[model samples]
Target: MDIEEVRKVASLARLSLSEEELATYGEQLTRILGYVKVLDEVDIEGVDPMPHAVDLQNVFREDAETESLPREDALSNACKTDGQYFQVPQILDQKD
Candidate 1:
């Protein structure tokens, strides 16, 4: 990339770069773009496009029916409860 292009990019990103930093980044970006250009020239006639570098598989446990905890037992550790349900402080103001 050129110095002007680097400056424009830095401005877009809200980065305040010095003259030396701008020059350095310009050279680095130019080299990175050069590498990308080289990659574009590589032959891939029969290669299939892949989402990931390695193969992936789902490994999950099978779901099973289970008994649930009793309501009273579940509310036992709660700081505030209305006997049947847990009570919490109001978060929003009441509107008319």
Candidate 2:
């Protein structure tokens, strides 16, 4: 592609570029497109597209409920706490 086309692409991608950056990207994109054009000429008679290079299988275990730590131990480091639970500022408080 030409430098003008590269500038347009940079605009569409929401990228800011100086004149030097535009020139650099223009050359890079041109070379990349040239390489892709060369690849387009290759023959692939028996090739198979891959989801992944290796075979894969699903492997998951059943979920199970588990108990959490005792409330006293869990809340031991709290800045402040009521008898049974940690105290935090209310989310809906206007001061927040």
TM-score for each predicted model, relative to the true structure:
0.43, 0.43
Query: For residues 1-96, could you state the per-residue lDDT of candidate 2 as single tens digits?
Result: 788998899999999999999999999988888878877777877988678988779878778778988898888988999968878878785674
In model 2, pairs of residues that clash are: none
lDDT of 2: 0.87
Number of clashing pairs per prediction, in order: 0, 0
Best by lDDT: 1
In model 1, the Cα lDDT at residue 92 comes to: 83
Instruction: Give candidate 1 regions above 4 Å deviation.
Output: 42-96
Tens-place lDDT per residue, model 1, 1-96, is 888999999999999999999999999989888878877777888998888888778768769888899999999999999999999878689563
Off by over 4 Å in 2: 43-96
Best TM-score goes to which candidate? 2
